[model samples]
Target chain A: MKNLLTSFLLIFSLSITASAQQHDHEQHDGHQHSDHDGHDHIQEADPALKVPNAGGAHIDGDNHHQTDGHTHAGDHGAHHEPNACGIVTHHEFDPGALAFHHISDQNVYNVGPWKFPLPCILKTHGSKKIEFFSSGKFNADYHMTGTNAYNGYVLYEGIVRRVVGDFPDGLIDIGHNALGVEQEEVDGKARDVVYLCHNGNKLRCDNKSTLDGGLFGGGITSFTDFSITKNVLSMIFMVFLMSWLFLTIAKRYREREGKAPSGVQGLFEPIIVFIQDEVAKPFIGHKWEKFLPFLLTIFFFILGLNLFGQIPFLGGSNVTGSLSVTMVLAIIAFLVTNLNGNKHYWEHIFWMPGVPAWVKTILTPVEFLGVFIKPLTLMLRLFANITAGHMVMVIFVSLIFVFSKNGTSVLGGYGTSIASGLLTVFMMAIELLVAFIQAFVFTILTASYIGAAVEEHHHAEEHH
Target chain B: MGGSVAALGMGLAVIGAGIGIGMIGSRAMEAIARQPEAVGDIRANMILTAALIEGAALIAIVMAFLVA
Candidate 1:
């Protein structure tokens, strides 16, 4: 069953590559040439605009974002002139960076080009002076600059730090820095070094603001972040939706009593029954009831998140794609499995019965390590698969941008729309199935793990 | 250079997974063919084993992505 699905996934990606046939065929040369020849091509691609160190754009084997490779080869005049400072800022977005951004927390939810900044709650460490504020304080103009300040705080890398400054707009030529420390004498007077203290504590200046090269990481700006990030908000919304849906179903179950289930309960009853009968019963055997609630919660929770991920309009925050979230889920599974382990489970892990002492020495350490490795594998599996799926989907969408002559000229995008759209549809169709498959896979694996932990091996031998 | 190596790594990951899964699938088909009535049981066991292999491959792909 899964083979067909897996084979389809592979075919979908191959066709995607095949669809961009002519252009991709050119890129095949880069792939064959490897690094050195690729660099030479990039360097010689344009000469008029070249500086001593053109620093060949970090194009991957596919030559993505360099769609003008042919035209640029003929006309070096198209290259942008180096800035007056003699430096060309090459803005290259590494795919790993894209992966990181997709799975990482954000203080804002971006839908396409529109950004909706979320509310942030920051408190000074120790004193815990909690101040609730919108991330808009560091919006377009204020972000990463000195001008923006709200409640004597500025945002950097999503962390709120306290800084008291006149800023870029109201630059007061104070004789001292923002930390109020006497600066090195400028014309025999201490040079003014504006500082942003973390909590207005002069002694803790190390928690200083990051703006204008202030010591941010090691400054007196010890602040605990309590921001309402995108994933947090999404998870909260999910919890609320699940609770309401399950509660209504529960009420329906109560009202139906002796009647055949219908409506909402009808929809969920079969799936719930499937988990109980197929997964839990098969794996855990007689002890299925003990872990049913745990298994079902994770199943529904992950299913909800996965289904939500397929809808791109809703900020597309990959909650399960985050390692931290999966890691925590894995940890919960670890705790339950060990906590429910029977005496025999402990004996097998620590000192296996009937095993030779020498063998036990080797087996004990491996078994001990297995305890951590199981959860680790579970974490990595969920996070990576979800992340990979999300990446593939995003790449499908980005192909439009990549085709449009270095992400410029909307005119080129319309031409490539047909091919990209088809690929996107194919990928999305696979993802819909993946969403359910992943949830089922995760639940069944959990059930199987629990089944192993609480299993009575000796009793089984007697039965045989 | 790094990207090429990363691509190679990702390719290797996929290849290893493909072989492992192909073996499992072929064996599973044989089992199902011999006992068509037990298809459901055979399918379940096959998927479980195949998924374990996929998990390992996914981890490798992620490590390769880190390099990319």
Candidate 2:
């Protein structure tokens, strides 16, 4: 009745929203950002400059910018001369900073000269961020470029600037070690080389300003921006909505006893019971109900994330697919598992039942290592599987290009394309299954660890 | 240097898991068909074995990623 109508409306609304999102993608093949259009065509192209594929321009010697593995401004030749006062200024984009793990051929899709669009967005940008493309276009300064493949980069509010240092060598002390306010002598006068906290790009600074037109438009956007997509937002909406609906129904069910669980409640009761019986009962025994709320929440949340990732336009913004994100989730599980661990569990690890005292001393470190390893294993398993599925699919599709490049051998290209396409389809189908299994494995393992943690001899006997 | 070899190991591990799960599923189905009334008992055993297989597969995958 009431539950049925609510569910019907929910489904109806979700389908409508999904279709609307799909329509936007079909309408525009590039990034789905309505806000991007607001900051368009502000900077006229410089007539004096021609876009060159100089890889990236290393302005501060830290390779601040890169294009095709080549830096434009080679080594900052003149600027390298040490200051007369012996004070040196060093600027660098901390070496080994996280960047895209580009899996396809380096020459996939070129934007301007050096910038390449990755198949997926790996990082996020804030409101005051600016992203620079090799094409001399910033998301804040340019309109939609002719290139359509850059649909992954989401540019929010930001500004772009290109400036050069003019201070004399002896007085300009722009070193990282200088704390608080930096003092520099510029033309026999004290000046400031304000270090930009935005990305390590030499040409841009993502200024943080709460007020409109307050500072460096918020932040510098990445060349291939991929922070937000509609599917992610919708999926988030779905989870919260589902959670809210279920909680409401549970409350009502509590109020009305002896009535059959109806609609959304009916759908959820089985899953809740499954967690309680299959996960909690086996692990925690008598104290199962104590952790039921968290376990159920985690199970449903993870299940939602996995399923949402499979949506047509979601791509890999799926946080679960990200190793760092999954690592955090695994960390939470690790913390909870250890925190809930009883004294018996620690004793078992430190001093096992059958192992002699001498061996226990040696095994203590191993047992401790196992504690960290379990969650580390959880993070890697989910991250690798999801990422591998995507990478395999990408490589399979790229095979078409490989054949086409080596003398558009039509038959070979088509044959490989079709074969790879079929394999990709197969992989996608497997991915759907993997999604569920990974979520289930995570939930169950958490339960098992909890069970192991709390399993005292007395508790084990009582359960049996 | 080590990344690709480890990836290969990961692939092989997954292949082994597929085979193991396939064999388990085949046996479980055979048992269920032989005694329809004992489907519940067969399913319990099947799930337990599948979990064990998955545990091994997951551990191997994790190791491969770590080395990579």
The candidate scoring highest on lDDT is: 1
Sort candidate 2 into its docking category. Answer: incorrect
lDDT of 1 by residue, A150-262 (tens): 65565433334455333332122211112222234333322323344322333211233222122111223456557787888888889999999999999998888999998
- For candidate 1, the TM-score is 0.69
Off by over 4 Å in 1: A1-100, A112-114, A123-128, A141-224, A407-412, B1-11, B59-68
* Highest DockQ model number: 1
Cα-based TM-score, every candidate: 0.69, 0.53
Cα error, candidate 2, residue A197 (Å): 20
Counting clashing residue pairs in each candidate, in order, gives: 15, 24
lDDT of 2 by residue, B1-68 (tens): 57789889989998998999999999999998999998755765566567667657877876675565
